[model samples]
Target chain A: MATEAGDNATLKRKAHQGRPVSLMRKTVIHALLLGVCLVFMAPFAWMISTSLKPKDQLMAPSPTLVPQQCEAQIDGAWVAVDREADDLDITCLLVRPVGTSYSQVILPDMLHEGYELLQTVDATPDRPWAKVRERLPGGEFGELRVVPVSELRYRAVPQWSNYKEVVRHDQMKFPLFMRNTLVIAALGVIGSLFGSSLAAYAFAKIKFRGRGVLFVVMLSTMMIPFPVLMVPMFSMFKWMGENQLGTWLGTFKPLWVPMWFGSAFNIFLLRQFFKTIPNELSEAARIDGCSELGIFLRIVLPLSRPALAVVALFTFMWVWNDFLGPLIYLQNQEQYTLVLGLQAYQSQHTGAEWHYLMATSVLIVLPIVVLFFIAQRTFIEGIATTGMKG
Target chain B: MALKDHNTLKGLAFLSPWLIGFVAFMALPIGLSFYYSLSVYPLYDEPAYVGADNYAQLLWEPDGSGGYGDALFWKSLKNTGYFALLSLPAMMIVSLGLALLLNTRVAGLSIYRTIIFLPSIIPIMAAAMVFLLFADSQDGVLNAMLAKIGIDGPDWLGSEAMAMPSLALLSVWGVGHTVVIYLAGLQDVPASLYEAAEIDGAGAWSKLWHVTLPCISPVIFFNLIIAIIGTVQYFLQPYVITNGGPSESTYVLTMYLYDKAFQYHEFGYASAMAWIMFVIILVLTGLAFWTSKRWVHYQGE
Candidate 1:
């Protein structure tokens, strides 16, 4: 009985010990997961922070994730400064503090006008302080006081106007680019859905001669790299332009017109989804005297809403993000998509004005990110199904 | 029999749009591309037959004295190979590791999954722009962070040595799609095998090696071929970020091809390069498939 009692106590102790150990493990795992998430999100956070920075703050020697406004210590209270600059020779900055107006004075041997100071300083034992007569804010003359540059601090102030400036930048024409992208994406999505779904319906439902061979041929085309077709496609578009289309090279036609016919991948995806639906529904519809086109339109499409949504979302995102297509075809700035415009913006202003550049990038990426969040399930499922089957 | 004929006619009608597209876009382009690869056909000029000179120049020509020794073709191929060598393994390992961690019964798994998958959805152009800002030599976020640890960051896209690696690193950052795919593959791994391994006194490492690896081998193989193809055709990131600059360090095959076709108007040469890339991709894919029989495990086989 004593041994049994000892066994019971040990078992209870073991159970008691297991609780905190598991809790600790959970905490550790959670912490690790959080750390990984932060690493993954760090780029986006940096992009957001950079996008909100003003032009001047963007070029600061040490980059700050938060946009900052310079502040000066005045009358023992930190007051915001419109402009502050530290002289190369002196420790103090000539700051135009808030709540006071000061005139600029061109000092002797100074390249630019120096801001009038309020006080003067005598030479200190440790440092050699320059003595200069300067105009005060109230029009009084006094020696320049050397305030340490370290007294100035920067406070976080997001520049909301960066986005506005980026959009309004003369070279970018962001709004026009966005409109072009939307028109192309919308038309392309509609065309792909209509054409590919019809093809998928025929492949999935209707019995046809050479259907097997044709379907295999379509799938094999997907394996052919885009580079292989790019040259000839360009030539074909050029040929069409010469014959009738009137320079299709610089137009949106080359970008979206191809979609009006169909894409192999979309057809394959829709076909897969269509195959999963029981043929009995289509058969019954056929028995009900519905035409083949009517059966496809009414029966197959209605039942394939989820798959259709997947197709639409993927197509929209693909068109939105496509760079090579626009890069190859669109020669004029007016014809440029958002992706192409962003590239143009980058090349035009390389290594400078990153704030505006990042803002532009954010503008381009935000729509798709929002779309993904709204249709997360479809996006995940579409990607998974495609990867698995492919 | 009459109904069968009617169905066939209807099917043909339904397939007409795609059939026309296939002929106009795919079939014609491929045939013309093959022909273009053989002849010296500038955009404005009639095709003058060169008879495999473009292919020979790309494959064997060592000097421009023979009218086709840019040497960029071989260099770009090497650069692409280097990029794939570094990036493919890094992506697989990191994505698979993330997949394993995510496979655990962690709290808020969906949130983690979403956050990790977010980067993949970002447009490559946008991602390239963001990386360009991040990889700035002076005052870039990446370099600034590196300074905190007392290391000076190299000019990522500027220096010859670091440019390809930088591009590869960029590829690594966008491994979210691969991670999602691996996560799906991992979910398909039966729980019973893991339980069996646990009962056999296998530790976590052994269980992962014996049970998990075999189960997901096919998925890995699939991702591998996809990555290989993608790496070979890697154009946008380099095109946007480097423009194949800093002494042509980051120039890959597709960029070279684009420069040939668009910038230099060497349509015939570009077509030849495209054919070479196609053949390379096919061989690599075929090689992977051929080797898959030795290593890739299929369930119930």
Candidate 2:
């Protein structure tokens, strides 16, 4: 019994020793995962950081992620300082006669807009102060003040105005581009759902003579690289513009119109989903005097909401993010999508204006990121299902 | 027979939208592209017949001396091939490794998955902007980080030698989607196999080799084909970031085709190039499938 007790104590001791090892393992795993997460999130964080930075700080010798507030030399040390109120009178160090006493005095009727020296004055015993000028609130030059020489410095501040400047930039009309993109994406999603669902219903349920052959043909279109069709498609659209649409070249028509015809992938996804629904429901609806269209609208469509959501979400993302289509079709700046406008902004101002450029990029990507978060499940499901099937 | 005929008619009615779209969009363009490949069809002009000339000029052009005018076809092909070779295996390995790591029971796994996958969803143009900011020579965050480690970072997108590799690095950053797909594949691997391996005294590495790999080989094969096709048609990254610049070192085939068709108005030549790309993709895909039979193990097969 004593030996048994000793063994039990030893076992307890061993268990107690094992805890730290397991904890060490957990710590290592967490550290690795966190490290990987940091690498992945670094770029996005950089974008946001750059977007918040002031123009001067953007090209600093060593850029920092967090935007720093303005600093001023105070008491012989650089320190962050608040801007002097507009209503306050400007103060200056005034000298009376050469080698006389220096006094801190207010320059009356002068508001501190920003400090600059107009001209240096040679001081004599009679008029012993150096003359400096301060620019007032307006562009008008203020009277020169005779004062002792003092250093002036501007503090670095986060430029929240960069976002405004980006949106209202002269070259790129960001709001208009966003409107065009939204219109195209919305219509594309609607048309894709309307057209692809109809086709998917037919492919899933309707037993046609050439159904098998046609389905295979439609699926095969997914394999065709876009570059192969790019030339002819361009020619076709150009021809169509000249002949039918009265100039569809520099318009949003080409971007969304093709979507109205139903994409192959969407049709495949919806069809696969539609096939899983019990045939009895549609049959009952048909027996109850519902037409095929009626059965589709009332029975199949309502039941296939999740699948349809997946299609709509994915289509929305594709249309929103489409760069090549807009680049090929939209010639005029007014018809440019957000993606095209962002590219134009970057190309026009390559290295400089990074803050504004990043601001615009954030504007362009924010919606998609938000949408992904909201419909995260649908995205994962759609990707998983499509990937597995492919 | 009449009822069957009626059913066929109804099915055709339902299929009309896709049918019309297929003919107008897919079939017609495909046929027209082929015809355009064989003809000199500049934009806004009727195509002139030039049978096999475009093909011969592009394919048979000797280096530095003869054939087509300013033929960078071989150069672009080499660059694209180099990019695919470098990026494809790297992406697969990284994504697969991430997938395996995430497959373990860990805290905040969903958040980790979401964080990793987030980059893939960002628009390529926007992603390019972010990459450009981080990759800037002097003041870039990446260079700053490298400086802390006592190494000077090279100009990522600026230098010709590093341009394609920089794009590949960007590609790896957006492997979140690939990783997610791989995670799904890993999930489908039955736990019983792993348990059985463990019971048989198999270590972690051996279990991965013996059980995990074979089960997920099909997924890997699928991803490989997809990645190849994607890399072959790669356009937006180079277009947005490099614009096929620094002496056209990063110029892929698609960018070449885009320039030919849009910039230079060499529609026929571009069409030929597109067809060549199409054929290359087909052959590569076929090769992948043929090779998959040896290694891609299916459950219950």
Candidate 3:
């Protein structure tokens, strides 16, 4: 790992200092990269945009990335209004029956007997206005009123309430699920650190017959999909639960217990890193009559902290993003992780409650993105140089 | 010899955790799954010995009867295959393209790299939720943007033709991780090769095609294999976005296997399907390894 970083440092120097690409070429490349970056970020950007949008604006004919709040003069006061016209011209009546505080902008076609058109305002597209009307629903109605299309304002204030509401969603107990996910993730990381490192040390530093075969076997296990093991593992866990072997299926046990069994990917990464720690240090320790575990604890682990961190980061990510594992194992709603809770938030999705859903997604996604920014150097180059793992 | 014996004993002792885990958790479960495949193991009932019948029904049962065997099995497998065919190439090209772009000296290169790589690492489930908003027909951002250009976007996740492609977009967005892998490989490509190519009067395109590509072919190979392996188990999006609906156009193999096992309690059929999937993965990865001999070049080799 150290050697690779050294190589990259020299490589970065040469590539930058050597290349004399034309100014025109650099301009073209940067422009292209900027465009690509925008395209890449659009979904996430849209997620943040939608999460803040007012629920009414969610079904706008042409949605804007920024959430908007539009208000027009209604009943002689500037109040919230939804534009309903897809046209430049329409004959409408502004009506306020006696005793009603609000007024209604009614089109001629739907004009009722009691609601007579007191005045026929020939409302043009630009100067479209009716006498003081209602502050109400969206394009589901065609009542563009007192304020002109030009006069109506679109503000970009984010609705932070969506976050609050999504957290408070009845089925999605986000705090509870978050606690569940964290407990599971933290335990899994601890397990990986404990279990994978010990095994990786033996694989890298110890010599035993069939060790090569076992190492290869471990590498090949990384290729096996979760589906292949999903069924039998489920059956085993369920059986254990039935037999009172500490409640595997519904609790967090099934999620974290298997983590204690060293994973192929974590083991492989640690083995590579453990191989890098100089053998002379271990030989010196061995000559001092330090036991193998003693040497591993006293010398090897301290040097391999960065590698162990990468493994922990990766494990935390896997557990946090894991949908299928939680989907199958977690039958009870209260026991769900964030992923399953997000799934519950959108159970009846038809684009109606997208603001809430997006808010929940952002909450779930925020930690990982923040973590990446913090450890990006190690996370990027470490995973990059290692090249392949889960 | 005495020292070697002592080391070996300690080695075995240190590895006991993994060894026990392998035998009990991995090996035992794998063996049991195969055993369950040959029997009619309902969730509630004991396993009834029915040798080879599950396999026969899954492979040979015909005519969309939805009886003993689901004809949707074939449809789901085809969907998975379509996803692989669609996603794998896009992931490779886009990721490699981004990497090549990143490799060049640009201002704020780290920022560009970060932006490109960010999507790949976001929780897949979070990605699915975001895509749900993006692919939504009524008010999704994609269609809204499309409306600006006078192009009415199809219901991305709803329509039969557009569903898998919509999914491919989601898959492609996450290739930022792959780009980093390619970036590492590209950096490892010696500068001397490019200098030599430049002296030989190679144009930019020529240099990229001849010098750069061959150098990164091994990375390309590794990325392609992982992408293939990953695409075959395409689960999260379909399960979240579509649930294999709109005439089952997006029902991938893993979804069907999941439903059979957990939802419908057809554990035997699911296990049989799983084994078939395992074999398919082996064959595909094996084929990748086999084909690598011709295309993949090593530094020393």
Candidate 4:
């Protein structure tokens, strides 16, 4: 729709337009858009800011926008502490303090002891200290200087190495978790996709008897809460001599075997996407001397790339992020996925040193976020358009 | 004759994978679970043919504790049902409203969509952590913000009265998927219908009621089915946020089953509970589909 200018612009050109209606509309729309944008962006802004603030600020009665500078005795001499500066710099005043925990004290505590905080050199959570070389007594405090920079050059410190430390924190190492996650997700994607695609193709393309009823029965399984199945499924697996995999495959079949059967949601999505393909293509393939297998591999498989991608992406995500599945199925920590590893990380730390836990969470989520960015359009379309033909 | 035989063989070959998977993985396991539900098969112990004891215990036993005990099973089902009931309607309406608001001819609509979808991308564990901070009863961001408005906020995740509702509200925060679905539905509502409604002197409310709602009923139906199924299986929010605490108010069926099977190792009774839940979901979904003939309007129909 074009901006209607006949009523408002005609009056404007007449030089007697008291109020510009279109302009008012534009202003109102702009303000509304800006307000919504703010609401959307607030959580992210809060996360970043809260991460930077000291732990005390996180639970403060009245929250402070920025941390306050405090003074304390650094060495024998007094030194100043200033947090607002971009580059943290410390000026020395007195000699070194007797206590080794001098770094633990905030700059404001040092300054209150009569030491002026010249500047804050660094206030990173990784390195909380602001290094200052204070002057001896009777020396001018003016010559001593501290500078602060806003940017925390964490990369310069190469805290990425701490990622390794995070991994090795307990039995829940990143490499082991990554290996398990990749293995399980790979098997799950292959199994579920293979099974679901076949089942979906039958439901969508085949003109078999009882196809509709079977499809409805299959889709109806979607309503069964997984927990409802979890208990029974475990008992069945145990009874099926799954533990006997120790003698056969030398590993439990619980990891990947279940997906060889179709999952209700994936089958529904694949079936819907499959049905959108015209039957004429399959019929034409049959006329061209192609068998059903040939038609599936040559015509249908190649035609269903987008749907396959959606299926694979979703399977990868669900299986990767699945905590309950791994928590139940996998017995050994060696078999744990990344979600299990995160659980272990939290349990190991028991809420102590939240920074490490948060840091590890950031590491874990980064790859998933990257994957989402890469295939976001398809992901959104895959989910939203499932209703188009239903 | 050989070529004709080969063609039939190929058809069977194409269909073999699904047939094999269905029989081996799904049908066998499901059948076995049914049998096990009739017997007592405790993990790390020999199975015993205790004919209908597990089911009976689930139904009539006032003595048994945990999964077989009727109180816990019924309580969990009630809690889970309560969660689904409160969250689904609120989430659907809020999502539709958001979709309608974003559907207006506004610039940066993609930005709004991205903002709304942001929560879905957040790892559930991370979101739980954030909510822990935000919903802290004493000095939380939620309570502090409310203090500014001169209204004292009650304990959200802390009190039994508010825990499940708090979890339900948390579910709505990730209603991004629903909003996207509604957007697709709104797009399909043919601009012509709105124009015709306007031409017939229908105001915005009347136009929405007559033109918009009817047009999107099928999409709403689709979302409703998916939402109900998803909510019934809800575990992560309650598991992480409340830990099924505040006197087990947020203890859902899934959580109960999980604790039984994994934590307590009561395999036989847990299996029975699971089977009952499966039957409940199956009947409910069947009923929904059966009733859709009346309300769920197809475009051609």
Candidate 5:
């Protein structure tokens, strides 16, 4: 494919020969790309931001990406208070009048004798400091008070320890989940690389009576959604469990053991990659009296490192991010993967504490993100080939 | 014949692992699923043959005021249909546009590609958590941002009217995978084709319409088929984000099938539902391929 620098230069030169690309066009192109990137990247940024924030600010309207510590003085002591909307239309503010429990939204200018002036917030949700609470002797919250916006102190105090706290959480055995997930991932990657490569080698190189038919049959299987087989597969595993056939139902076997067979998608991908390697190499090995398996191991497998890496990475990813399989197969708490554990954590402790949930999510996704950076070219090429080479 | 037999033996030996897996996992299950579809297999007892009563009940009770077969069934089908209608085009167009932009000689292409690709690759469960936070009706970042500009945002997941659309919005956010595929297809287009179009005095828009789209039509077809198959069995995100909430507006086929199979333990009925989904995918994919003959141009074929 003419897709490298040479192709780019020739296309750019020939397509617009009379006029070079203008600054206006470049700026517009960049502007569009930036907007798209912002949409794509904002959720990740927000996820990490919400994860590191304190529980109090978890539901703050117009939440900030940065963790903030803004306080105001009420009853002569600084306290944290939730603010109303960041709308800056009206004059004056609402405060707990130091006596009544329910404070009124009042005009600050109306009270002449005991009223003090208060500054309007900076018209951004970033500066909502209207409410105040008393910081008691041992760092306990005393009361919720609506404070004047005046004399408010603000600082970016990010709760970077949320990651640590989530790990240390009682209900979630983060380390145990990590160990289980890694165990499954390791088995799955091994199964896929060995199993899919061998099958792909057969389909790509060897002549069989029904090879074409079998290959198409395998490709067609890719179109069948998991839901179609979800029930009967469950029944099959249940039968295994009922007959005491080596713990298929409630064990990791149901999840990772299937990969020891061929995956249609990975087999297809590797077969394409295998065919691209010259057939003469295998012939030369054959002439040297190498067996079929020996040629596959010594020549084909070593030469197809990139394809194997792609297969391994993809298989690892599927195992890591798998939800439905774990949702059904694994029964006990001790058998939970990170994704299942996260869902269980959410269902157990719903809504109020999102910091922990988001933090747990980030923890689950962090390894895949790291792998992407480590094998950037392989990941990109592998993904692109799956779609195009089809 | 002798040589063929020898090669066949070796090839079958190599493929033994996959062959064993297929018989156990796919072929056996599919056969049992069909058999179960005819019986009342509720896991507690041995499955009694109930004939096609499950299918009859599901289909006859169209309760047309609702989903595909029964009321909830029809509703699930319609909901999935509505989602597929919105998400497929939105992802295709946006990803194609972004791919075209990226295909141009741009500074910092890798940075943009990374940003775009990372979201699509993240765990769907994690992405759902983000959407859950970002789309909260009252205190969500989306509503808050809308409020800043003096427009109120709707209750995204909380409202029946907007729940599927909210999922669609999230779907668009992860269009990076499709974009990468499109970029690969675009780069594969020969530069000489563009040069020829230029010499023929075709402008940019005409050239894009005539030359570029035709070349990438197969990629589009592939994306459409994957998206359709995916949309018909949409789960995970809706399960995590909305849970078919706000009056079951986001109740999709797979979710209902899962509930029937796992929750209610009605393995037989769920198998029927699974077969229905299978038929839907086959018909839809068959339609795409049938239509592709007109629009999808294979250059060397």
Candidate 6:
């Protein structure tokens, strides 16, 4: 085309320029689109990267992101990083007695105290400073050059027992937290979705007196900040526990009972989706002697699968991640949800073993991440279909 | 005509599950919440009929402990409002931009859509943790990259000045839902209209402005409404990332209300907060709906 245009006069070249102009537009759009997509994806990329970095690298200056090669001292032999080790470093800050003159001490000499902080330099075969230099800050060329192995005050050791310690803590238990979270998430989702679906069906399909008023009223409930109701709901539940419903409903009633009725938000969403279905379909069913209930069950329910799946998935995610609700409703440690458990872990380990806490957090977030990965397509469809009104 | 009563009853019966749930969960809780807002319901004793004391305290009382003079409640409301104002518009623009991208005949368009939508499905708990990895102070990937460009990243989620904006930026990543809606709206736009504009010597920009904008105005309105409502109720990201931290710069209404109810066990006060929030959402939504008619072009209309 360029050769042909070159063979022609100036008029032909001018006409040929139009082709490139459209090409430029296409190129610009594609570039702009790629940039926007990357912006949308940056967070997940950051998350996965952070999850893989080693603890020392986590807080290091120019942290070695590609896990560094390190020698692990095992049975008096040097093992590589990620290699099995029988010995582990359990670094502890030994506090001198309050009245004593020494402010604080890092005890390398306390060999009989059961924990031995493994020195990386001592374990490496030759040029141990090279290994130490790689692990420590300032690298090969800075003020802090590696001293002889004996002079190093601190030893970096792995704490394999920390995970067990966290799980078995007396004030908090991990398994029970998992069980409670599962129960609450499962029940909350089922109850909220089922209850909301019923209410939504009414709002969407039924023609009754005050239907408009009822919908407005239902929507009005959305405006009431949940915190406003939190106090009343809590008191009511505690009161119920102490008196009337206590004899039968048990303490968990406050947490799960409201799900049977419906959430205004879910009802609103379901109703909107339901309205999209043809009214004539229901009318036809009625003409064929099908009851309204039959139409809802046999027709509306089946056709509304996409919306229902969305509602279920959303409800499940919310209930699973809910922190404040379970904290307020269930006082028993045995009844604590996964979020509460994380909070409890935060409280207990305010200063130490944060790596284990991070690990536990990974455990907590893993299932939801997996679920999201599985149902992500359906979830998007649901959100997009639900009407842009949050 | 005689069978109409029976038909209505049948319709009502189909709606019964929702009706019963509405009264039990939505209506009853809301009413009780209103009543509780008007009284004092300390956990250890009977709720005293304080009769507007909670409302008065929320609005007028200067005492730091209980009344309208309370700094925490006002602060949280202010913070929440600020978040909503900033995040809503940003979300709309970004989501629309995404819709424009996905609107093309890209190779593996569905794959791109799924990848873009992935974050929206991530439970806030997980995503928030992941966000912290990138937004963390000193050593996070974001700051590390910024250093290479000779620009220093602020302590993002940790800095009081930048915290809310950081949270807002985090929200832009999960706009796949809005994008999907915009894509649907964009697809609905008739191709002939663009063709007509082109024949009239309109450039691509003018064609998009005159034809595409008017066609998808309603979708924009829908996205706007949802964004506003969702922002007003914003809790999860701020709550998880900063823990409303760096000195409560990101403290939000829901979290403060949560503190009042569960942490302090101030039932009446929390209820009042919730009620105030409800009013705010109602007013905002009403405003959106009112303004929508002017800018939003309904296809049928």
Score residue A277 of candidate 5 by CA lDDT. 76
Candidate 6 recovers a fraction of native contacts equal to 0.47
Q: What residue runs in model 4 are displaced by over 4 Å at the alpha carbon?
A: A1-43, A48-73, A76-168, A240-253, A278-288, B1-12, B60-69, B147-151
lDDT of 5 by residue, A1-390 (tens): 111111111111112223356788889999999998888888888888888776667876557889776666666766554344333334545444554554444555565544333433233344334545554543356554454455666667776677888898878889999899999999999998878998999998898999989988988998888999889999988887788776687789988888999799999888888887787899998999999999999998998888899999998889988999999899999999999999888877868779999899899889989999999888888878887777
Which has the better TM-score: candidate 1, or candidate 2?
Answer: 1
> Lowest lDDT 10-mer window, candidate 5 chain B?
B60-69
**Model 5, span B94-136: residue lDDT tens:** 9999988887775898899899899888888899988898889
Please, what are the lDDT tens digits per residue for candidate 1 over residues B191-291? 77877787888976898899989988888888888888788898998888888877888888999999899998889989999999989988998899899
lDDT of candidate 4 over A1-390, digit per residue (tens): 011111110001011111233566656756765675565555444444444443323454665434322233544433433222222334323222344323322444354543333344444554334333232333223222332233212111112333555667665577888888898889989988887887777766665545657667675555556665566566656655565534212133566776776676777677666666778888998999987767777887788888788888888888777877777777777877777777766666544444355555666666777887888787777766565444
lDDT of 1 at A283: 81
The digit string of per-residue lDDT tens for model 4 on B30-133 reads: 67667767878777786677888887876776654444447877788899999988998899888888777666665677777777876776677666666665
User: For model 4, what is the error of residue A147's alpha carbon versus the real structure, in angstroms, after optimal superposition?
Assistant: 19
Error of 5 at A324 (Å): 0.9
Give the CAPRI class of candidate 5. Answer: medium
Give one clash count per candidate, in the order shown: 1, 0, 0, 44, 5, 11
Q: Model 6, residue A154: displacement in angstroms?
A: 20
Which candidate number has the best DockQ? Answer: 3
Q: Order of all candidates by lDDT, from best down to worst?
A: 5, 3, 1, 2, 4, 6
lDDT for B224 in candidate 1 is: 89
User: What C-alpha lDDT, on a 0 to 100 scale, does residue A167 get in candidate 3?
Assistant: 80
Q: Give the per-residue lDDT of model 6 (tens digit) for B119-191.
A: 7655565666656666777757788878889988899987899999999888887777678778766775777
lDDT of 1 by residue, A264-345 (tens): 8788778778878877888898789998888888888998888789889988999999999999999889988999998888
In order, what DockQ does each candidate have?
Answer: 0.47, 0.42, 0.57, 0.29, 0.54, 0.40
lDDT of 2 by residue, B103-174 (tens): 766568788889989999889899999998899777789999899899999999889989999999999999
Model 5 CA deviation exceeding 4 Å by range: A1-19, A71-152, B61-69
Candidate 5 chain A: worst-modelled 10 consecutive residues by lDDT: A1-10
Task: Give me candidate 3's TM-score against the actual structure.
Answer: 0.90
Higher-DockQ candidate of 4 and 5: 5
Residue runs of model 1 more than 4 Å from their true location after superposition: A1-32, A72-87, A90-151, B1-3, B64-69
